[model samples]
Target: MTVLTDKPESPFYEQLSGIVDEQILHLQDARGIFLLDKAHERYMRYYLRNVAEKPWNNHLLLSALVYVDKNADVRTIDELLQQVNVRLVDLFKIFHLSNMAEFNVETHMYQYLKGSYYQEHSDSMRSKLLALYRSLTYSTRKWVTSKLNSDQQSYFEQYLLPMPSYDSRDFSFTKSAKDLAKDTRKNETDVIVPLLPQIRAEGHFRWNQINRLRQTFLKACEQAKTTSMDLPLEFHYDEPERVGERFYFRLWDKSSFVLNHHDQFSASSLTSAYKRTGAYSEGNNRYFVEFVKAERLDDDEKAEGLWFTEIFEKGLIGRWNEFVDVTDDLIQQKRELLYSWGYGKNDFTENSFPFFSKHKGILTPSTFVSRNKHLAEGILFDVEPLYAAVTFGLLAVDIFTTTGARINELLQISNTRECIRKVKVEDKLKFSFYAIPKGRDEVEPFYISEQTMKLIQLVAKFLKEHYGTDKIPSVIYRGNRSHLFPEPKPYFFQYHESSFNHFAVGACLRFLLHGLNFESQEGKPVVIKTHLLRHAFATEAVQRQNLPIDIVAKILHQRDIEVTGYYSEPTPSQVAQSVSDLHDVISDYVDLDEAVLRSGEELVNELEEYKQKVGVFNNVLGGACTTNFVCPTKMQCLGCQAKVPQPEKKHELEEVIELSKDMEKRFTEMNLPVEVKKAKAMRKHARNELKEIELIEKYREEQKYEPHIQFKK
Candidate 1:
């Protein structure tokens, strides 16, 4: 057993009085020192043998084991120790260890601890020979669980996978050194510095200045990807450097350091928002009106407005009759009154801050989902206006929003996931929410799946990695002072999982119409928007060969058939593809050998017999045919050749077989491109040949093959 010499020292008399043999065993086993010491001793013995025999695996081990106490060689003097003096002198190259024994011990200890991994072996394997060594180390008897099983051994091995490899470079400090140079010149890194200062400059990133700089840097990133970046990169009131190499790295590194330093400033700003600290200590003890804040609303603004009633009344509640039946006029009237103070959408007095759609920023998968949830909860009143608002959102923002779901859908999904079931309605000040009851036996499940959940989770993971956990906002939303997810995020934004439907629709409309409400560089209305997706989805579904509208509706969750009908039905091309698939299946069935067909019949019967026990759907016949061989001919018994005996009513086996054969032939003919073309050509040829006697005789004979009739020529 591994001996732990660090055990508490006690008087001999006290130790003898308190100890029992079983208790001592338990201590050795629980403390785990028994196994470790045992393993170390065994390994040390093996190492010693290797040093004596191999002599070359490690020259240092050879010197230490063979010559430590011997006088054969002067070089082997390094292997010897004067109990303390010589060991100290020989171990460390740092600060002549000969001067201090303590220094040598520290150097040796440090080396022992700095393995590539902190804990490479498990407690069990550390002392495999515990039984043999326990007597030598301590007066105890102990046992442990059996050695780790295959699964457990694999688990431990996987756990150590993330630790530093032996070859891992110490780049953390090297990263910081270059990062410091970046901080000195934050802004103006893209463009060359002019000889004269046109305007007095401050270090703050104003919106206009920030916009220009963002564009400049985006160009630089693009240029870096394609061409050489020899230009000096600069930042706020800082010097530029040759940023061609490691363009993005030093920027992120320096930003991290800057954010770390500014954490106090951030906390203070949020705290001030909450407490109304500085400018609100007037005689009335009231926070007065100040500049309108887009990031935070004042006390008057915190009141969640009854947005539903206002927009619903203003021609917004036109789409879904489902909501109309669920909602009422009394609730909506109150919502309209709430909007009288001015909705956030039309108001631009806040210095042209984000005043469109559900919230600010480019249309993205994350933001779109959030917006969708907002709309569903009646945070925004109308789907129609919501559509228009999205036009503003996407068109105004620079980022592409088409990939995510409509913003309205995203919001509803988010609310479903986050809505705490029954008990309180304290959070939203003015916005109205419903209270849906659940049974005691039921547990509320999330509506936003992993696909949608990824939107916000990606944000948090990114923040933790680049900004550090300390810099993240305490809340998911930053509304009442403790804001979360601030701007200028340190990391490259992680990709979102949801579709940016609303954002795309909003942007496209603006691009096509050229800025309905907000000012835009492109004067015409934007062409794309979330609403167009409804059309796009319908058109694409209907035109795709073999894809049915009903199936597409199920995918899109269409409750109203009319909404689906607005999309055109399957085109001629789509029908052709469906016919093509059917032909392929029939071919496979026909090509099977006669014996294989018999085997298939037996298998089908067996499948049916097992269905009841297996809970298989008996209604579905196995694709294979079984023992029964229905005759393929379709003629009546007197005229049919395949039936053993014909039925009087003429539903004989021969008749059925013939009908089956004819049906297969007809379907097969439709599948053949040449046959289909020939059929069309024959129809046209007969129209031109109608005046001829031969053609007329042939046409009549074709229809005269009825069993009861004979044609007279």
Candidate 2:
């Protein structure tokens, strides 16, 4: 119903005209909003893929395109926009988008049908809709700005440069305790010791806030019944101290009065009684606090308090978990409650009526709070938070435990062919998770255990069922403004009740740890996070298991070995134990006759050269030893082409041959055909190499001048 008619004389108007010329603003659209054509849509997609990574830039563009007017004067446009209470991208998502299908349009009016059976969309659409909306807006703004002349650009900057901003309070949203540990160069022990308790307290605060709201709602319902009336649309209160007593009051500047009409004989009488409490005035200003229904709540008004309506006429008012009425109707009612929190509403029909929503004019004590938790407490956690915690909790646990992916990399998973692959592992069928890791340029698959694969499938199945789609929906993260492209497709981790993002991912892990009361190996409370799993993986691979650094780097998808070096470092105790063990191996195995040793220094130099050639360690022969060539296989050094024939080291070679034969026998007994084949080949190669070493030792023994190897040494 709101429209800007007739162009005005102003520099801002001229810019608007230029934007219209570029087809960025099509005021002729049904809602007097901008709509994208096929060509423009493609261009926007390209921009989103290549340039605009975050929604902030897109939001600014859309705010200007959707809310700005050509008729407004350049000098007053900023003030006018502020007065209009322009809706943020979050608000637009809640009310404007009914489902994914409607999201592409700039802004479309949605209606609720009477006696309708249409299933409402999932809450996850919030982020999806915003992403697409911002992409369009960002592309449009870029196009408009590019076409601007220097004078027009200067005018645009002066008028629109100061953007509307609000704090999101997302400081702890992205980084997990593990991520912080990596940045601060602290161990998990140090990080978890402090972070775990704080997050646990945060969780408790969140739950308690919800409980208070639910209790208050129930009490208000009881009061309504005592009065023989329907649910109250709004709650008025005097002060925090008297909130328990339920004495309703409204306060004016420097004065306050309680609503004393509850004892009135009839509903009409009570209405008439309170109607006289009109707007109070001081110094040419008058204002009144008005109550409205939740269904009609809009972004324009600031939220005052909650409204408990009869939308749930099923007479269901208790703990959310116990309620069996999961029908579409109940879900819609829940959406209405969220909308009243100044986010967005699911239904915006004319007769919907507000139960919980914002209000105009002066606010009472119950109306104001500093954080979203104050308004969100019971309303949000009641139906969806638990489900989210369970779903994403299991997801985070499995992904980290198995593949050890970074949190952002996990977010990149989608039920697409590119993200998943089936491969054989240890001779058994297993899944290979392929992804382009954070800060990396290439994609590779990391083989995960069967258990991890099953968990991933479970999550994928749930998403498919919940969205009712065969196609996989991609997970996307807005990055720095410079790189705005949507990640290569198929996002697997999505929230069922709200938009999925890194913040949600971290919260899920924290909530999971809180719920499980988990502790670390050091007996400290555990704070599970994405990067911690990465570090754990590296430590196990390079230090504990003695895998190669380059291989560890590849598994972690690191661009260089230096980044992985931090994680792969051995502890002081680990280093000391390794050195002690190596000393024992050398003293037990190295034996040389003084006559053949000729120069002791020459023998030491030869050993040093061999160690340098093999880079100091080779465990495939059962223990660390000097080598002059690379091992040909990933397994033990049984099949190494560069192994030296040392008669004194004959026992180690014999042990390797026996180990290979034993491994092959086990594979055959286990009926692992693929592994049996590999093991059989390794055993055959080890036997041949052992025979050659024995022949060389026999020849040395036959020649009395040549010192023979003594295996007993």
Candidate 3:
């Protein structure tokens, strides 16, 4: 056995006692190659130890491991390399099954490789596994080349196994625009729009109700004592109509017992007394219900209980039926009240009710009830964390829908009050919050509506109250790359659970949507992933709000306008409308005959031919272009007569005129006569287009009154 005691031995080291060399374990060249940081060092050490267990004594396998270990990036080590470790173990098992002494490139390995690829049912998994295999082969070649002379390296490279190429046509992994649009419509109509009002109303109602009950519970705790002479303890409800008239109980050393409305001993409701009294035990720790009994008040009360059996035997079931009806009516009234506030039938079921048997059966009393002294002092202990979580999720939905932030960006929102700030734009105050956008190290402002900012502030106020702090406490994020020396950031999307990550945020959103009982147009249950909200925001901006693509791109924090275009492509209906509008714009500019407008197909064909002659027909700033080929005028559409100025794009043309004037001034100062002349010409063309549009608008206004005045094109 090669005993190496320089460092602490890994748990997996025993499995590879003799097969691996001590030098390979102490290899310093691979330190920077694979992340040997505190977060990932253990995984690299374990991987090396585990790979050494392969029965075959092959230098090629050792070389491949070292090569990949040194060359892999942090992401590959964190995510994909784990899969590679498992696959390598499986490959080693294949070598044993084939009875091979070492890894042979020309023998049974190729057949096994081909069969493994074909065995995978998922196209994506197959692609991933193939990439890993190719990586191993490429790394092995590189490692061999570094260890050998040029002539020897070239000869060794030819014998290496070739990797199969991935097919480009298989795009099942990608989502199309149509798929995104469908998701947007479903989420907008079924969940996001409907759930907003419910979250606000229910959150407020539940918060108030819980606080009121909490105060009553605290008062009852102080009033009822084991040393007190009061035989029967009492805890009154704030609103008797919601729960019941009152709860009468007697707390003993080991357990507690309940008394019914008539002050008669009730065994069935004893379960509630046990739970409530357990919450109020000394030191606030739960009391075990070992023994419980309702003591007799006097001889007369005991005699009344004994007579109930005779009354039941004497055909007096009518009285029992009356009591059942009254109980049912109270429950029905409570259900109706909840329904009026948009709560579904499922929410009031036995599974959800805190006092019910089913709820108590699965959940411990401590799970829902808080025993924190601060919460008790603030009269907020009765509020379950679930209600607060729902409120937090509501804030998340509002931020996502309004600001179009990625889920990670939303999770990383700073809890500082200064996170939300106001800036004056064109003399109007606009609100935006600073957050770390995806793929960026520094924070940027994400603009939100004033309404959203108010809701966020309200939630922050409640968070401070719950935490008993002037400022929300900062906690380190514990997901993904956070393990690598993470600093604490006061992320806003957290609750009692300090380590809120992407999955927890996702679960909160899904829980709210599921409770809302939303369904899609096809009657299937609505499923809203957080990323879908980003798609909805983009689609709404383009198709409904009609915001410019570049403006939407900037708001979405995308550097490339073309990438934003994928998110905001026009639907078929919008494209048809745009084409219809384009036809009218073309008629106003060109002297076309009636034959061109007689048929839809002929008009479309003519438009295509006209676009070919013009240069480019796509919609651009200021108006739609008439040309099909690249513009020889270098997209100075304002100066080109081939461009049609749109009334909707008049604002864009005005901006162009301003830009032209600024350019002319700069060019003149620099003594660039030709550049200044071009700028002047561009400004003149824009002014002329604006004048023509104004005259057309004036004529249209006059024609509306005259009715018979025909303006020539």
Candidate 4:
């Protein structure tokens, strides 16, 4: 049991408070004061020693202190103060300090009114403590800001302010893919583009092509091994980074004698796409297709020699045929294995997979699953496209579009965690889900549509059926390695074997959009990256769904509405259309003072066209501007003296007068002085503008058809 008492004037607290106040008033060196705060240090040490458990890790304080020291500036100081304040609040709560208490400077004792059960510090002490904390924080910030250089201050402010890290890999890759489509429009294709069709061809054609090529090369190598005594019978694929070189093979049609048996031939045989450069293969480990003059193809072509000789004689080789060496063979041998590659027919295997196959009940360990499971089963399933459609197709798109989630957030929905549930919202039950997204400290529940929920379920079911377990590997990679953290969870978004990371997810999205030939309204290939999906979701929520920007921010789990507002920024074309619309709406009311619109008599003819294009723009009913400035006053166009109402809009101006009167009536019912005062000012401005419009209308009516009255020069 703990005994609590208050003595109105404690000497220790009085000295501490006095020291803090004095330090705040005379603060100069922020770093020095922070280092010398014995009270704060003592509290932190005590907290670590006594109360640090579970969530209260000592590493947090250590990291925070290090971060503040490294970034010793105003922003860092401010962040430190916030952290300290939270910890202080936690400390106070732990001690059960609730009542009001005052620290008397003269008597050196804390004073408080006692309840029957216990004595505690009064609210005055709490107030003083908070005030002192704030003063110290403010002083420190002021000192640091005053001391910082312009660049440091600017960078600090820019980084400290809430903004999305938009250039994440998923976002950048989508933009790049869109750019590639643009290049295609200009009739310009990079070397990779031509090879893409070979590698990313429909169905499992690329895989089959690779397999046939590999078999032929190994057969040639085995023949050479029988003759030369030292060579591996088969070759293997290079690492993923070296995959590009394996595709660069030259075709040899079945006419010239190249194989031991003509029956071993396919439609065409492939030779090493690599050219035999006389340069030693020691440092140049990568394969490049070089076309050499036929010195009878340099003497070592076993099964592939005759094919190369025919191409060489026909002058088919050139300098422009260079490709990146993606050869799998890393070992250095005396004899070149470039001669050890030839083409062969693909070996047919029995197929058992089916088209549109359906399975019921729970998936088990015996599920015969592979990337090409459908094709292997000979079910006429286009497994390539289906693999993408099943893994990162509809569910991914729905989660991204509806939830405004970052890519990682969307991927965080694993079946291992019982995330999706029916939560009551607005007196109706909806399927909302939970995910502990990146940067967020804890699990946040996000409400999703029923369609999205179903899509998620479908993907979940597919993942289990494909992997034979609900527990798929988590997304963890370090440097050149993946699966570093091997703890398996039922991840919703993954391919046949890979646990989807940013790169895999991005590649799938690009492939899907490209395969589907998707395009954006901007006449460009649609950018389908994860962050773009989030932005698109936000934009649609505000522009189409009519959800509040703040609500969108909440759904996206953003810190502020300002960050969410970035997605809603208008494009140039959108701004241009808005200007056109505004011109059409107010053209009937205001006289054209600018020459751009009044250059010719064709204006009357174009009036109908403009109206047709803009339709009957009605944003003016609440007053509007096309410039997109965030006006301080909501009803800015109505009340601004520089933008007074024109005579032609008198009917609308009269409606504005009525609206202002109604607002005034409603504003009088409000008790808040500040809001009432602001509303009154707005109404007063509206009335003044109304009077001006009426006067202008009366003058224009009188002056009608009186333009003939001209002064003598």
Candidate 5:
């Protein structure tokens, strides 16, 4: 064995001194609310009460004290400590101790096997409590720091985190002198023992009865394995603590004990652990409570959150407690945790056990990804553009859809200049879609401008730059005039929120989980997932200058699902530049319909001359000159060929004016039921009148300059 011997300047003792001091202080701080101690206190109390025994020291504590601290060579003792034959604790004056039985004065002898080590537990004080004492309160000084390695210091601190709820004593012991005030027996003046505690109205245990029962249990359950189940433990008789309850054990768990959907303990686990290890189940067991368990904490046993070989030795006749195999217990725990989320072992890993377990690590991508589609995609993630696309896809879909749209839409170009002289959308721009859904005899259309067309060109360039490096399932976009979503692998992200969130949050969580070596998959982790991205998008939708929720919702396929909302609109600055860009396109083409109205007024001024021209050959006949009697000239048209310009209105101009008024009316409609046909007819009338006015105005303008036009008036 490697040993750090004395006489060196920087000796083992000096290095460990600070760490050990800090550890002790931590232990003292843990005196209250530590799960391990709380559990032990309960078991101890229960056993003691059941047996009805009063002993100075507990067997469990003695074993620990003797096992960890003793050095046999430095101290020589005549007393022989035969492990198989040794008693657990012996009286040293009034307090019971294990070393007193193994003590030898001759050579100042103390050996680990001879009782210089401690198991680091008290029947009442917990492992965490003891650890806290060791780390914080154990020292007289208020502050302590670690000189040990960082890992050791971390280990020291971790052991002290409190269980969620304080269940009081693990098992009640007979009311100790500290808990109850002394009272002399009424019949006998000299005899004194604490009275049974006053029972509360509720079923919960009172302090007196709880402590008394705890002690009784320890005694009754002593050597319980080879002995009867009816251990010598019971509460002091007092109104039964309540009407019907026989017992209660304090919870030694994390604060999340009361959270939704947890495991239930049958009280059998305590006995099973103790019987096997002579150590109660604590940190590595159900005792941990609410916090997510770290893989580092996975051990058959832990002392102050440090993994160690938990065994005992005493002389050649050894009585080493067996290691508690929590294999089945852990399996049950994992299954229970998964079940709460509506899944079974069959849902996750093929073996249903995490590949990177406490004892197993060489898990490869194949085994780790296994059958999980979401996980597999996540595993394939790199800094590649596809990674951003897939990961961003989640948030994007929530903000917009393609729920699984690929990058194909960003690639194609259309030459619209070939079809029309003036392109409705820019002729230079081409549009296509990637991962958009298709229908029979129909293809999804993408509205691309020059900017998006450029984005596709960039994607193509990028694909070429990293050609043959594609790790994805397949590439679909290549030629033109096609749907980007090709055959075979249809769904990129399956329809599940957990899978979506997993992709988002799992990025970070998986990384942290992996670093701590959790029994889960590990790779270059993405710290954020899709929903978080969606959350960002949602927040941006509400808080940023993005499109309104309704429009965004429609983009994300949520419009049909929502009800009426009249949210405030944004100022122009907040909108994406694309809206402004589209605005510029429209502003360049000011509606000529309004300008046409102005020209119609001029034509109306010369309307009579045009009437003469149609019949007497002066200038022009404007479809017999339809004129608006609804116009400003309406009163002066008594002998007019057309009293209203509506008489000569063409079909198209009428439609434009009608469309504008209908749009204006919709603003005030607000779910108001109205007849569509009647509304359409009124709109049509407004348009037709405007058109006739335009025609009459044009006819009058022609007579003003034509060869021999003369006004009838």
Candidate 6:
């Protein structure tokens, strides 16, 4: 066994210092690396790590180990089994329950677990905790048991096998289809629907404006360099005169004016010039020219009223201390000016520059200038924050609503131009992006519209240019910066400083919704959760657009089509409409041509009497049986001519056809001639029924027929 000393410099050292036992740290995995070392570096970074929440899977696992037996040196699967005994489930329960209780001291865990409370933490918190415990235990057990010897594995199976089910035994309360739809619309869809167009428009506008400013700045700078003009050359003809009431600082400078120790002008002289004209230093020899309005200026000060534009010029004033002194004097003078102008000095303090602190790194209005409306008119303050919010917010909404991408998959989208691919489908091309779905190692193509692909590419280009990097910076997923991805991928959905992880993207989305002031049908303010957008997408696809459930499942990257069914549950109105449409389709199927039946009145009466005589029984494949007494063909409605197929059940018929084909192939391989013949007959019947249903649907689509004859059974 390799004896390893704890490295204090390790990032995990602090988190593990108090919670983990020293003996546990000494334990080794199948590899020579210490268990704690592996846990800190590699184990938690695996696919099981919870992306939606904080990176605490390793911490929780270590805590559980310590709780089981701090002194037990659990080196192998057998040893862990011996340590945990048959109390593995109990151990996790105690750990999670205690943790939840401690975190939520106000609520009683016993009551919460037993379903007494109606607060947010009642059902969801319990469910999440149970899921977390189950996931952690399964993952840890799999990792340990994989390296065990045959005899040891057998020993584990015999004694401590059949892991206790953590499935919450409490009564499960499920929402009805109507209730689910109502809740979803009131909470998620309605909120997002109103805000989407607004966000898209605003985001697009801001993006265009940012690009315009960038282009104008580049051109003005080039012009200044070529012309050899004095500092602060204004361009009145090219750019917009105002961005509201504020004038644009269309001035250009070839190089920053530096006032070093050898310069003739002192910091005091620059401060005096700034007091008369709204000008201040923006460190690194850069300064912003504020175009203050004439109304704010003193009568004695013979200076043009200037307001501060977002554009900054590279020009130095003095040393750090001198600059600070100048700023302090200016602040004092501004306060006196405000006080003399009947405004309170307390309202215009250093802290009032919230915009500057909120957006520190990005280009924003100068921090030195007060953001009071009276002081600066039409100045684009909070430019970067608004830009980031609107632009990123729209990108996230568009991607989520359009592609039905989970938050994690959306965040991990590669920044490369090749991320979005175009594949030729017959005569036309379709666009898709490759993303690693949750719980899967392999990547899947998420097909998106051409328009959405263009939007993503535009955002990617802007991000690359803004960061001045060839690619967007690599994002650290869940704080496991090293082991999350095989290599650093420049994730597209990120800010300059950090990636827009689940929480950040959520915050961005909420920020956009908050501005819209949209209200739900419940007459409450709209608050949208990001994941609900996925549900909305699925629901819309299945219920409104009538897309197949299997197709939606594939788009959502769900392995189970049943899960997709839960997402796209039809509302009551939808169910009624589907029933009505099915009635119409059935009626159309039974309709006789007037051209063939010349005795119309007698034929109609006979048809009505015939419909009453036939019995309608619900068949297995969502069709109705017209047999009066019993199913003479032993419920094989597919081959029966009396079986009336429903439009909504078309997918079920298709699935049956596929299953029959598979069975026929399997029977042939087994040399069962009788079974193969039966399977082939079943497949043919299902195909014929499906084709008839398609023709009926086509007839219904081509001709809108009001229900003239009502059939009763």
> Would you estimate the TM-scores of all the predictions?
0.21, 0.34, 0.46, 0.31, 0.19, 0.49
lDDT for each candidate structure: 0.25, 0.39, 0.45, 0.35, 0.25, 0.45
Give candidate 5's error at residue 465 in angstroms: 6.7
Q: What does candidate 2 score on TM? A: 0.34
How many clashes (backbone atoms < 3 Å, residues ≥3 apart in a chain or on different chains) does model 5 have? 108
lDDT of 3 by residue, 1-713 (tens): 23445532444334444555443433223333211222334344545555344443233334434443454323444344455546545665666554233545444334444455336434444445555656755666676567546765565454344444432233343233335555555444434332332333333333333334334444444555533534234333212222212222222122232322214334533554455455334455432111011223333343121111221222111212223333655555554543432333535552112112111111112322221211111121122333454456566766666556877667666655346544322332334577655445467867554345555665666567767886777877644344332677666666563746665666455434434445554544445666666665665555544556776776688778987777765533331011101111101111112223346665456455544553333556666543333453456556342344556678877987999999999999999999998898777767766764553343333223311111111
Candidate 1 vs candidate 4, TM-score winner:
4
Q: Supply candidate 1's per-residue lDDT for 22.
A: 18
Query: Under the 3 Å rule for N, CA and C atoms, how many clashes does model 3 have?
Result: 6
TM-score-better candidate, 2 vs 3? 3
Worst 10 residues of 5 by lDDT: 192-201
lDDT of candidate 2 over 594-666, digit per residue (tens): 2243465754564565445442233335223222234323445443322223445658767766776888788
Error (Å) of candidate 2 at residue 5 is 31
Highest TM-score model number: 6
Error of 3 at 383 (Å): 3.4
Candidate 2 backbone overlaps, count: 20
Candidates ranked by TM-score: 6, 3, 2, 4, 1, 5
Q: Residue by residue across 1-713, what tens digits does model 1's lDDT show?
A: 33434442222212322322212222222334322121112223443443222212122222222221121222112212121122222233434333222342223423422322225422222121121122211211111113334553343232111111221122232234334433222111111011001000110111112223233344434443455432222222111111111111111111222232344345654454345455222221211000011111223334222122333333222222123333556435433432332222222222111122223233211222222222222222212223223222321221111111232332222222123111111211011111111111112222111111222333334334433443333223211110111222222121122222332334323322321222112221112333333343343334522234554443344545565555433322221110000000001111123224345566456445443331111111111111011212211112111111101212232344455456556757678756545444433322222212222233223322221211111
